[model samples]
Target: MIAPMALARPSPQELWEMDRQHLLHPWTNFGPFEREGALVITRGEGCHLWDAEGRRYFDAVGGMWCTNVGLGRREMAAAMAEQAERLAFSNTFVDVTNDPSARLAARLADLAPGDLNRVHFTTGGSTAVDTAVRMVWYWQSCMGRPEKTDIVARDHSYHGATYLSQSVGKRPGDRVAEFRYKETGIHHLSAPNPYRRPEGMSEAQFCDALVAEFEALIVQVGADRIGGFIAEPIQASGGVIVPPQGYLRRMWEICQRHDILFIADEVVTAFGRLGHWFASEAEFGVVPDMITCAKGLTSGYVPLGAVIFSDRIWQAMAANGERWFTSGFTYSGHPVSCAVGLKNLEIIEREGLLENAARVGDYFLERLQALEALPLVGQVRGRRLMVCVENVADKATKAPLPDGVNESKRISDAAEAMGMMVRPLGHLNVMSPALTITEADVDFVAETLERAIRQVTDELVREGHRIG
Candidate 1:
């Protein structure tokens, strides 16, 4: 039997005060937060969240684009609790191992495509990326090519906030303000963005240009000196950029020709966010030397991440028997996290959530695109449920709103006021609903989004703000 609901909790004012006084929020300006209370969310279920006041809103952000199965799955919770009670704190420290860890490793090997058979566990995406970086260096060292230590990533790419991951990501304004920025052959490539193509060039021509640029960079940098090239399959935090047709394939060919390792950062795109187990395999049809994934692995049940190593990488490491990669987090293969991940994967397979994302995703995309008729929407781009609406000042000129003006934030705030949760990624309003979302739920998203946009646009117009 389901447990009875507890009585309503204390007011949000109390919680906010507690948070400001005691909690150190990530990536926050503490001074502003001290003056203004934090957003105190209390509960979540399915595609909805309830604040301390019990106010419900559609969770369009999916808890930072991770919770693909949605909120409050008792099954996953039970699995975690059960594992915690049974054998919670075991370590996978080379010699010692746990059942859940071994099982999860095997399960990931089965799920991953190509010869990605070896699983190296980490705490989350950042650590996974860091692990990949270390592995690349180690592989080079093993192959007696220790000089091949440089990495290449695309502009607007987001790997993570760790030392090496941040070094690898080329996102503007994401640079470490305090640390010295390294320029160790980490080349940047122009993304296959068709909207901002070269003058008088079609998308096909633009794709060719981007490919040529990357290939030339590989030669200029001397491919022998570079370890690998890494990128998100569809740039998620990079404004949900869906590359031009044939773009990913060309990049793959370039990497192959240069003998540079290819890495797919699938942290945000894996596990049905884009209607696929692995977005790289499903969308681009390209395999990589290593794949990093987290976020949706356990659908936010517990902290988990992985670096899936291919057979070649594994063999190289194994060949150097005494000199294994000495890289692992203390909680890398936490038993509870592994058990929860196992259960979560079973849920995805049993419920066919991957297929569900594909089936219902078209409706979501179509309805989101329908919003382009609005003057405030400049573009709608995504695959499956991983969607984005880029706000522009003028559709004809494709100009953005004033810099320092958070138009996407304003729209998101408006949506929240209208009882829907939306997230602003720069000037782009984005959503990645639970993979289990229904057609009716998608319809509601469309209707509610239209309502929010209309309200915000009308207000902006009243304020005499220029908007597309």
Candidate 2:
């Protein structure tokens, strides 16, 4: 077993120096960071966090948009430890499966919308999405349409990081933009960005135009050649771009009409993040063929993910002469992770955290919009705990700043100095806290955000940055 971390105290300066000298962080440039230090988070509970220096602050970002159930969960720790001590290693391959794996699969089947009764486990969101992509092509092959294997994903929609998942993700973080995965028949499409809609358009008209564009893409790609279409029901990482009303439903219908399998990448939006077990059923009134989920599944206590599929796809894949599904991970269904997932679900349901997200999320959304009066804030958009504040050059035109402005980074840095951590996607400041956050906590987030934006905007105005 890997050695446990020692309970030793270290100074912030020491830790930062160690990070600079030894650590290679992901998605980071180490050269510039060598001169400066890193922010070290020490502890968290409820909707708050403490830095290495013991400064308390509200966790507005919820640790990379996970931690839906909050932190310092003693019960979760106990559950994971108990499982680890028990049957810790068991392969879910061939005829071997653990009790927790079976039980958690059944629990998820019951909770999933429609007939997504078959659960395939993985270690995290990336692998789960990677598995889903492979499964779609495999299903197409099984159905005897090898050529119908194209995938269509929306702009700025984040699926995951594995090859196929990365290819499908049109998110700004997508480094694969210049590469052509189209050799494998994967395609990208545009989404209805309501905040930045074209001139002389109402929200309803914008949605209609979006629908028409989507239909045009399907036709242009040839409906017979497209195998699957995947999306995040709320587009969390894609600037929390919540669609206008009926947007999701319309997209799902278009997929159905084109005979394309619909997949929902619910890695961030599932398990009470959207005040529902799954956001698809709540917002779109339709269930997808497959739903890839991670993050809050075990509330970040343990690493786990799942690709839930309907019986139609499951049966078709199973009844074939091929015995193996041809895709999975060694720790796909780890016993400890399964046990933690079961416990996490129990806590979420027993404590009504989903309902809390609904109630508190409504309050947070209303208050977040109040920041629009500030010059830097263009539009505040999101649903439930997932929200984004778009930074614009001019509120009247809704135009984003020039690429050199980097308003997102400036505002985020200011928030951190104010003892809060926030991240930006494009020109939008993304915020998603614990589902258990209270109304007072929500207010604190709003007030702190106002302070951060005001500070940044004031500095920019004095510096002659076009924030107006």
Candidate 3:
């Protein structure tokens, strides 16, 4: 056994100095990081995390929506160590394969909906999405329709950071750096955000309008030139924007009639985050042609991602004879990562985490919904364990907080002081705790958020901001 080592640990000030001088984090402001440095989390166990200074805080965001099984599981650590000792590395190029990878693929095929039985492994969610888009283009080429290469994605949808994946993604904040493919044949459709829908329109009508807009785009762009329509069942990073009821099903129907492939980006929704292994068909009644998943596959114990596709695409490639489908990563089916993923899935099933998420998620969301009664809260929405709280200056108009308010960040900061952590996205605070969270944990989260928002609201009022 690889037991824990009792090495001398750095003090909080030393750690902060090291981080400030070295680490360059992702999606960081730089200005603030230069002044404040990183948070320097030291340890995590179950649903809580401890910083370098030994301060404990509730992990409400689940480690960027990936830690479905929480942290510090000895079984998961043991599985990883065992796999590394046995067979740490192997390339899945051509016919080469490993036992864990093959077994995990078969298991994922069984859990996936419809004929999505084929699996292509990658290092993480970005690469998984990149593989899915590449496969779509390759499938079109194999069908002898090379012109069908354009992809349709929705505004505010976050796919990944790879070139092809980023090209298809349409997040405004991600694009501010002006780094993107100049002409990637990617198109955007309106987001089906019910809270921002046209005034006086019912949810059903809003759904219809969004579908009609998609249809119009297809007609204008010509379905013959479009290869795929990629979407997240619930847009997590984009403020947890859940589409109107029946919206995903209707979109799938249109894609079916137009011969356009549908790719469900379930990176944040898969592996018990939404009370299921995959949420596409189970929650939304849509079996996409391809489903990209990662994050909770190993419950964030290790880095792993995969693209699960229907047999139709596999059969099409098989029909193309000896011509190779030549695209893969160096660590495609990494033995250690695959072993950890399999063990993670085993833990989730054995512990009844899925059932717990379903039962407790209802109470969680119900508690969050009650926060809408607060003056600064415009909306609280989510499904299962994934939820978002949108801040607004006026509930009557659904207007966002003032230009420089940064309400979400203020609330998050306050919540951290109150012993909880929540993700701040623009004017929204997002939360997706581990599947192991209980009703008692839910109560802590709700109470902490209420206090945080109330404190921020008071600050805004004193600062001369005209907030609700």
What TM-score does each of the candidates earn? 0.96, 0.95, 0.97
Residue range 2-90, candidate 1, lDDT tens digits:
44435644467767787888998866666678898578898999999998877899898889889988889999999999998999798
lDDT of each candidate versus the true structure: 0.86, 0.85, 0.92
Better of 1 and 2 by lDDT: 1
Q: Candidate 2: minimum summed lDDT over ten consecutive residues — where?
A: 175-184
lDDT of 2: 0.85
In candidate 3 the C-alpha lDDT for residue 233 amounts to 97
The residue pairs that clash in candidate 2, if any, are: none
Better lDDT candidate (1, 3): 3
True lDDT of residue 443, candidate 2: 80
User: Which candidate do you rate higher for TM-score, 1 or 3?
Assistant: 3
Error of 3 at 313 (Å): 0.4
User: What stretches of model 3 exceed 4 Å from their correct place?
Assistant: 1-8
Top-lDDT structure, candidate number:
3
For 1-468, candidate 2 gives per-residue lDDT tens digits of 844436665578777777777877756645567777577778888778898788887788988778988899999999889998998889998778999999999999999999999999999999999888888888887887888888888887888777778778877756734565434577777776787678889999999988888788777878889999888888888788877888888888988887689999899999998899898887678689999999999888789999999999977777855757868889988999999999999999999999999999999899999999998998888987899999998988888888767778888888887877778767879999988899988888888889989988898888887776
Q: Taking the candidates one at a time, how many backbone clashes does each contain?
A: 1, 0, 0
| Pairs in clash, predicted candidate 3 | none
